[model samples]
Target: MTDIQFDDRVAIVTGAGSGLGRGYALELARRGAKVVVNDLGGSPSGVGASASAAQRVVQEITDAGGEAVASTDSVATRAGGAAIVQTALDTWGKVDVLISNAGFLRNNRFEDLTDEEIDPIVDVHLKGAFYVGQPAYRAMRAGGYGRILFTGSSSGAFGHAWQANYAASKAGMIGLSNAVAIEGSAYGIQSNVLLPNALSRLEEVMTPGYMEIPAFAEALQSTDFSFADGRMTPEFTVPLAVYLVSEACTATQGIYSSNSGRYSRVRLAEAEGWVSPAGTTPPAVEDIGANFEEISELRDFSLPAHNYDEFTIAAKVARARGIHS
Candidate 1:
């Protein structure tokens, strides 16, 4: 087969100053994309800022003969997000791809996580995607084609201790991407989420003593033995992300996870539930308690594409029960 090239594509990768974002920006530029490298150069806890980080990545791309511009705008606010996209339009005339990859972590146990701690994560990870994604979606709708990717995390989907705030923010991103996928489907725009498990700066800058905690240590130890051998680098996760944001990708509304060379699609599935007879009174609590096994069984489940799909499934169940609207 032929290589997937991004020639003539204009991509906006937020948080492109380092780690996974940097890897993606460089790869896209190398493949002929005109990239906007947006990074606020903030610390892992989302405090402070600088422009040197974004400028350095732009320099790297330019040094390698690739086209790119640097934007030091934060992704935490609406104005910042629009400015990042506007930089792309100002420099390249249009945007074809968006990788919402800018994020930082403030890990703490649920009880200890205050508003000051939780708000920034939500602002950067969840709202940041919204701020950047909406304008990019509009541009893609007008341009007739686009690819969008949001950075999600296994912490939220599966659960991880001492990361309540971070996990909640990441989980919200999955919902945002799903909505974007459904709304943009008719306009040639595809949106998906990436749950990346890689060794990046986010981990390096974790709150002091977080890594030394026994639970965190045990969680790391339980992973496959091979994962310790330098296989979980950010570069390993870049190829899948690049593909998801490429024109060749037809997948939308997908949640994918990448870790130590393992790649798979993560889905939210609903089991076919037990339905009561239509001509009788509503089922009692005892009835539900008795049929709990059947109700919770996952043997036959359907993956609903959107909200309407859930309604369709409910309709099918109602029809089977001899009830019609």
Candidate 2:
């Protein structure tokens, strides 16, 4: 197969100062993309900022003979998001790809989380994607070409202890990507979510003892997995991300996960549910309780592409039961 190249494409990667975001920025630049490396240079806990973080990445790209510019803008606010995109537009005239990867962790147990803790996590991860995505999406709609990738997390999709805020924020990215994918379909723009399990600064801060956990340790030692220095590094996850944000990737509304060398699709599926028989009095609570197993069974499941698809499935079942809307 021929190599995929960015060439004249302009890409924006938020939180590009370090970790996963930095890995993405560097790879995109290396592949011929004119990149806007946006980083607030904030601490892992979302406190403090400096220009050096973004500047260093930009300098690295330039030194490697790639085109890039630095934007030290926070993605947590609307103005900041717009400024980041504007930097890309002013520098390259158009944004062909967007990787909404800016975020910091503020992990806490559900009960212990205060507004102070919860708000910033939502602001930077969930709302931040929205803020940066909307403007870039608009630009893409006008140009009639774009690829968008939002950073999601297994903590949100599956579940993890003591990371309620982080999980909620990351999970929200799936919904955001779904909306953008549906809306942008007519404009030739695609949006997808990525759940990456890589060792990054944010992960380090959020799970200080992760390596000590038996499951993590065993996974690290597994022959089935591949890693650098016994850890899943951000670079290991970058290839998938780069492909998802490249023009060659035409899939939209996809949720994919990458850990170590394993890559897979994560989907939301609905089981074929029990429906009340026609001509029978409406099922009672007792009836529902008796049929609970059938209702919850996972056999013959279907993945709904959107809300209407659920209704379509319900209508089919209802019709089969001799009921009409």
Candidate 3:
């Protein structure tokens, strides 16, 4: 395969101080994009901030002969988000790609998850993506060229224990990207979501005791990006990201799962079911049971663009059944 190169593109990557964000920053730099390295430089729990993490990644890129500037901005706030995009404009003129990789993990059972625990994760993971993407999205709409990527997780789309907060936040991103993709199509902006399964500080947050295990220690030192239980190195997830954000990508509103070199798209769909006329009274309990098989049929369906699409489908069903004029 021919090497994918960024050439004159400019990119903004959040949470670039370490882990998956670091890998994305380095890869984008190596591919010839001028990068804005953004990191709150906070701990995995989003407790405090520092500049060291962002600075180190910027240094790594610069030392390796790639162009980059460091910005310490919290994606949770509007002002901070605007400042991050401004950093790219001031340094490189415009933003062509955005990798919303900044995130944290805090795990607790559903009953034990408090407001403090849930709020920050939602703010950082979901709201943060909105904060940064809005300005860059506007810039892209004006320029008529941009790639926006939102980070999602398997936990929410699939399932995981002790991750209710994290899962819900990530799931929101899928809906966000779909809206962006639909609206941005005319302007040459492509928005997509990535559900990454990787090993990083975020993973460490989920399983704190793993580091102290001798077997885990030995495995970490010798592992070569294997997914023997679905554990993947951060490096394993970057190639797909690079492609998605590159100029070659024309696909949008797609959700992909990547890990250990395995990649696949996730589809959200609907099932065709029984329908009734709008003015009809509610059906009796026995009537519902009589139509159970029809309600569960999956032979045909409509993929509604939004919540209101259900109404349109209902109208069509009524017309087909001669219940409506």
lDDT value, residue 231 of candidate 1: 70
lDDT of 3 by residue, 1-27 (tens): 778999999999999899889999999
lDDT of 1 by residue, 150-193 (tens): 99999989987788888989998888998888889899999999
Give every collision pair in model 2. none
What TM-scores do the predictions have?
A: 0.93, 0.91, 0.86
Local distance difference test, each candidate:
0.90, 0.90, 0.88
Spell out the clash pairs found in candidate 1: none
Please give the distance, in angstroms, between residue 275's alpha carbon in candidate 1 and its true position after superposition: 1.8
Alpha carbon deviation, residue 320, candidate 1 (Å): 6.8
Range of the 10 consecutive residues with the lowest summed lDDT in candidate 3: 207-216
Query: What local lDDT score does residue 97 receive in model 1, on the 0 to 100 scale?
Result: 98
Candidate 1: 10-residue stretch with minimal lDDT: 204-213
Clashing pairs in 3: none
Candidate closer to the true structure by lDDT (higher is better), 1 or 3: 1
Cα displacement (angstroms), candidate 3, residue 324, comes to: 7.9
